[model samples]
Target: MSPPRQPLPHRGRGAVSSPHARFEPLAREGFDDGWDIAEEAPPLATDVAMEAARSIISRNDSPDIGFDRSINPYRGCEHGCVYCFARPTHAYLGLSPGLDFETKLFAKPNAAELLTRELSAPGYVPQAIALGANTDPYQPIERRLRITREVLEVLSKSGHPVGIVTKGAMVTRDLDLLGPMGRAGTAKVAVSVTTLDPVLARRMEPRASAPRKRLEAIRALSEAGVPVLVLAAPLIPGINDHELEAILEAAHAAGAREAGYVVLRLPHELKEIVRDWLVEYYPGKAERVFAILREMRGGRDYDAAFGTRLTGTGPYATLTARRFETALRRLGMARRGGLRLRTDLFVPPVRGAPGQLSLF
Candidate 1:
């Protein structure tokens, strides 16, 4: 049976409210739509927070990724990328992975304070901390939230090195902070540009900054002396695959010093969301897209094995990698070898009242 489609709610233009739609778990009669173009109606969210004692880090053991520690100031991204792997995480909070992941958002208002405490801890280690590994640090709510900026202030004050991945041009607002970090070797930024086609980008990453704006962001970050990395992440075959070379060339010309790519990964609820998106927007190409993805993923929708998941297996995957590598080589850009971050610089905060002297 086809999944029922409901009208997704919009918080009006430029409101920046969480726009994810909820999936009604049980069968109901009124919600049938052939394409499953569900409109996720959700109330505008007010900030809810948790007091974090030490929020500076999270350790990861996934061999597929390079970084060991990461910091996310928010939960539930507003960008609403249908292919996002982080969507499943919302389920743990008793939220529907479908719309709740995007509509009902959470903010870590104390992230900056906790980060400062963590940085000052006695045994704290400082490898390059990753920002936006899960939820985008610079999502639209950030304009008012300012949590991400607060955390950056903590990192900058401590002289800690950090790496960031984001799709928002809002990062430009922090040029004052990032430029100094870049000069001091304390910061680097990578902007993910999935496709240059505005139409495709609009449908796929409904709320993300437009493609041209992202290239402009690359230019701005580069001009500010920040080492910029261009990421053509989660490349969807038969969807935006044809834009690969063009995107790389555009980003390189726009001053991206390094480049990388990840094939589309549809893990958990994302499979249904992305499938629904395709059927709605590209009805004729949906089957072919899924077919190519399956072929690349060893005949499954997705293979979660660390090594094979990020980059798929089989002939089609190999060709995609080859294409990316050739583009990188021609542009005089490296394949983004492991970036070793400084961990020895971490200093744990003194444990005592604000002004109390600690005798160690």
Candidate 2:
């Protein structure tokens, strides 16, 4: 017998239901007229579990991605953006990629220590390390955990280069460290402003910072002498696609020097999660949205092919690219190119006998 399915939770969240993983038996619940009604279900509380990661740095070889090494201080993001490509990763932990992925979070408390040790290794080479590649490092819980701040301290002390991408305004709290790094050409920040529409932002990313706050963050970072880049990511077709030029104009006016964009990518379980969200929130335009998405993905929900995954290969995709380029050029925004960080300033940590005297 299949496991019984439960009704979607009523909390202000993104996912509609937690469908069984592929490895688990499929099931669905049915309602009967004989059931009695009671009070509404209470909201689910966020659960954070600690994970002592053996390693801190993750290496990637994809040509499309810019950074070679990256770190994710948290496992599952609480931002709860329905279009997050990282949602499917939670299934490997035997958890649902829907609601469970957002509510059940994991924190790597020892990330700073692990990073220090790794950078101290003899074979370690200094390179730009990307933060928040998989999950936002400065999520709400980070205010108390301080794991991300600790990691930054280690990198700053070592003179290592680092790049951060986030939607959290909390990043401004670390201006003391980032300001110096930026002046030394060792740091850069990309603030993702998905949409200027507050209502749409709330419905899509239930727990993320408001759009205006993100814009303020960009301006603050820019004024602090940090190189700020605007990322209008996951541009949903027929939904927020119309806001492309408007987002760029807003970011540019807010002091962003460069801008980039990515079309909506629904990989693995994200397709179902996002579809459900659209049905519940945007019932009228759900079908039209899917139609445009399919047209961009070559008549499929998604195409994982390496070269064309980030930017699809179709008329709709081409049109989006053109529109973005045209807007960027007209706004005098610099095109994103190679961002080189200073590796010459790196100073590997020194660890020897406690009282050993140094010899020149």
Candidate 3:
């Protein structure tokens, strides 16, 4: 039999436990024995492995999402947002969606090469390829791997439109490539700032850029001519929801021309993950937070219906939407990705030629 698993201590991580995968037939938990025999576990460190994916493009026909296709340069985000809807994807790899979702990361070293091949396919269609849709393309590992940068190089050479969504301030490092493309109307970026409270941000998203840094990233991207949109994503009620207008205002003052928001989503193991986190960090408000979320999510932890997935249904949801729209009007920010990136500029790379030839 497998050994019992104890709840992991918080070590600058969002998840305090590595729960059993839902697919596992048996579950294990550590309990305190009268002897107090268990020793404190050491802090968790991140582990990244290369994934040789057959394809880099992920196509989705969901009506709620804006893009038809997207690319994720990495998997299992290190930012470790407790409310991340993408965390459950770790289960597909036989890993726990708790700590495993953040500590066990994957880098797609060949992503650029694969993207080039796919974009050059005979029947390939040109459109804005979304980045950071599932996992953040600018996660900390990206600084060393440079996989996301390589992918951007390929897209820039072909004049392909690419839209990026991230909470990492490091995205500004690629402005040299994004600048010219933005000038050509072929690049855009969305910066999601969940709260202006640094303490809350640290506990909720342990490694993501601070709220101020994200706003600065928005300003930098906009100044470089890239269309910048601000996202008050996963806006937790009784937590950051009260700062909705303030977040939009800060983003607008930083030069963002668009804004959007998604209520907190607790899908799959996320429900348990977030519940535990709330009890640990905001014990006093945890019940009320869940109560408000349930009210917005049709009296459940989450609602996956197409139309209501991104924007929930009910009175609170309606009020949130109304407030968002009103804030946009006051700030003169569009309630979308702002400008359409130009797909007509795409220059397909010659399939069998040297990579350098594509730049011309």
Candidate 4:
């Protein structure tokens, strides 16, 4: 028989406990007798492993998402946003989706090479490739590794249309690449700014760029002639939902041409992680917040259905959608349909035979 688990102390991370995987029937626990239990030590420093990937682009057929093809330069994000839905993907690597998902990272060092090879292949069709679709490409480690930048270099040389979504200010470092692409209508960027309150953002996102810094990035991107979109993502109920309008307003003032928002989504291991975070930081309102989410999700923690997953069902969901639309219309930022990224400019790489001159 397995012993009962003790609550893990908050360690400046999102998840409170690394619960055993459901595939395993047994669970482990820590026990104490009388003596005070010292606070849990901070997680170990981040460890990055280079991954040689055979393919860099991933295709998805999800009905709700905007793009069909995307690239993730890294596996596992260090931003440590408690509401991040991608955390559970770490379990597939036999790693804890809690702290391990943040501290243990993987980089696709061969991503650019693989991308060039794939693009050079015959019968290849070009479409707008989404960057940072799963894990952030501009996370802190990017300052040193620059794998994302290398991938951008390949994409730029090929004249491939690309869209980027990130919360890292480090993205500004690549203005030299994005600027030309943006002018050519081949690039657009969306900066995720969850909240304007520094304290709340600090607690919720931990290591991501500050709310104001993200705003600055938006402004910078706009001034560079790159179309900027502000994403007020993962709007937690009874938490940051009240600031929805304010976030959009701020983004518009920062020169963003478009805006988007995603309601909080908890799936698989993420459910327990978010719950733990709520109890630790907002114990008094935890129950109320969850109740509201349940109401929106049809009396459940989450609903993964195609149309209803991004925005929940029921009255609260409807109201949130209406509020977002109304705000967008009022701010004169309502976008009809989705923004079309240019594909006509794509130029496949030329692969010449060894020691042969190109017939230009």
Candidate 5:
């Protein structure tokens, strides 16, 4: 006989056709691992909700961050990095922090329209707007959604300075728009490389572009004269932390002139999900990893203090920072070199009169 089904958590979407809904849930006690043993469900019809956002620029005052205003074209990320800090955000939408965060995504279809209007506002001040801050702009759904590309087009046409960070090679497809903007000093790109070890990367990030592919994307962007920054983000301790020096070396060889890294941050539901993933994939080393994380996080799973959130607090975290800094210095990699897009260079596109400028 099959195991009894566990009650499905309310996702607030009114029960739909979910493949996992029919499967008899495995007993909670049977598995030796911590991951929820629910099977993959059938894909849902992706619905694009046109959010008529009052504004597009997100302002932040965090001292550690590089930019002030950022824009995210989509809500949930399909790449499904088990350690994403943004995963907890889906809870505010009344969605499950588990599968729903990865599967049920929301795209801002009106992002470009809203952004254009905002940029043309009476007192709009030009600043380098960041793309893919919360969730990747080039997630797999972007191929069909095209919301990110639309936003890029708006920025390009308006001569607005834009900085992008993504792990998707799909970004290369937008070089036609980005290259010109780059030459005009209005654009720069950052390609994040998590790990060169394919096996670890596959299990950690799942659907994100492979590490090698990300390097190729950096090379491609650099060749096109679009400055590329290599981002070695979310460096999980005792997991893929050993690759620090190697990641920098590889990125430098790929023509990356700048590099940056963030210590792994597990906020709220992300702690549970990432821990579950660790137990499932590296059962034996799971304990060691968690122990190291606790050491870095002041004996907790994570620390969210403003100055210490992105980079952890304790000795281990400090050591990791030192190691990364040493490598960057040796490689002559400056943190802010690749993306120096000039906001002073912005010139708004002229909106011509409907029928008057046709032959003029």
Candidate 6:
């Protein structure tokens, strides 16, 4: 067995190190000698495993977000956004939610097939299914795998309403499908722009599309008739919070008709992951950042309260929300409701497909 040592930073990867999952019984770390002979951590190469998912659509009763159902094409995201709220989910697979969450991934190549089976079931009622609600559907690997593309094709063919949220420029690759669906009011897309500064964006979301590319994607999608919404998400206090208006302005210029925002959420193992990242990159501001985050989160790293989880509580979070609303009004955009998709147009995909359907 190799000596357990701290992993070094890998360029283009968001996580600084990989920590053991929460459920592990025995935890271990490094023992360094005075001579400093520890090997350097190599650049992480992404590896993907195929999962034959039994079902595709995921239902949630959470009151915060608009959607009731969502679909995740891949288990772990390769975008490597250190601040991703979905990071802790990797622990359920008995893997570290740090580096392993980005380096080691699983693709549901059978996702579209499974979705067809679910949509065709008797008493199946259609609602807007969210794509990329957890992990990005158009992550780099999808450029080759095309699993997301297949799922979109299935959704388009059946006229099923769907909405997509992504930070990838690769979403434009499916404009051929999304264009018609958007015009038909059966589909819409939300492009998440974290920051306008390329440098800050690189450090935060390493492998996701650059800030400029995302803006361009918004322009293209909008031109194709998709009701594009700019999602200024996970606004990190004392870090990128100051850029709220700028991000919205750029997206509005790029043709985004609506917008939304979510304050940073540090759930489960992510507290350590983000804390270490701040210490490394913004050491001077690290202390101040957490203080502001806690102030918004009721003196805690996170709160799961249904209504306030996405926004938060107290003055700082309230100020952020106020600024968001004010910007929307300034942009001549919708102040409250986001772009809604049409579920009334859905048609069953398959007559009788193999496998048991989702009970939801």
- Comparing 2 with 4 on TM-score, the higher-scoring candidate is 4
Please rank every candidate by lDDT, starting with the best: 6, 3, 2, 4, 1, 5
| TM-score ranking, best first | 3, 6, 4, 2, 1, 5
Query: Taking the tens digit of each residue's C-alpha lDDT, what string does model 5 give over 1-360?
Result: 454343332232212111221123432233234445666434444445556676777999888778899999988877877777787787777665556666788878878777877787667889899999899999888999898899999899778998998989999999999988877888999888989998877777767898989999998888888888887888887788889899999999998988888888887767677766666567788788888888878899888888788778778878988998899889999875445678886765544443344232
**Top of the candidates by lDDT:** 6
Q: What TM-score would every model get versus the actual structure?
A: 0.86, 0.92, 0.94, 0.93, 0.85, 0.94
Q: Which stretches of candidate 1 lie over 4 Å from their true place?
A: 1-56, 338-360
Q: Write the per-residue lDDT of candidate 4 for residues 195-222, one digit (tens) a residue.
A: 9999998888888999999999999999
lDDT of each: 0.78, 0.86, 0.88, 0.85, 0.78, 0.89
Off by over 4 Å in 2: 1-9, 25-41, 351-360
lDDT of 6 by residue, 104-138 (tens): 99999888888888988889999899999999999
Number of the candidate with higher TM-score, 2 or 5? 2
Model 2: ten consecutive residues of lowest lDDT: 1-10
List pairs with backbone clashes in candidate 2: none
Candidate 2 structure lDDT:
0.86
Worst 10 residues of 4 by lDDT: 1-10
The C-alpha local distance difference test score for the whole of candidate 3 amounts to: 0.88
- The residue-by-residue lDDT of candidate 3 on 128-233, one tens digit each, is 9998899888888989999999999999999999999999999999999999988998889999999999999999899999998998898899899988888889
Residue runs of model 3 more than 4 Å from their true location after superposition? 1-8, 37-41, 352-360
TM-score-superior candidate, 1 or 4? 4
RMSD (Å) of each candidate, 1 decimal: 4.2, 2.9, 2.9, 2.6, 6.2, 3.8
The C-alpha stretches of model 6 lying farther than 4 A from their native spots are 1-8, 37-40, 352-360
**Superposed Cα deviation of residue 39, candidate 3 (Å):** 8.4
Per-residue lDDT tens digits for candidate 1, residues 1-360, read: 654554543442112222232343543245455756656655555334443434557889888787888999888878877778888787667665655666668888888777777777666667788999999998888998899999898788677889999999999999999998886677899999999988777766777899999999999999999888898887888888788899899999999978888888887767777776676567898899999989988889989988888889999888988999899889988676434445445445544566787687
Q: What is the overall TM-score of model 6 with all chains considered together?
A: 0.94
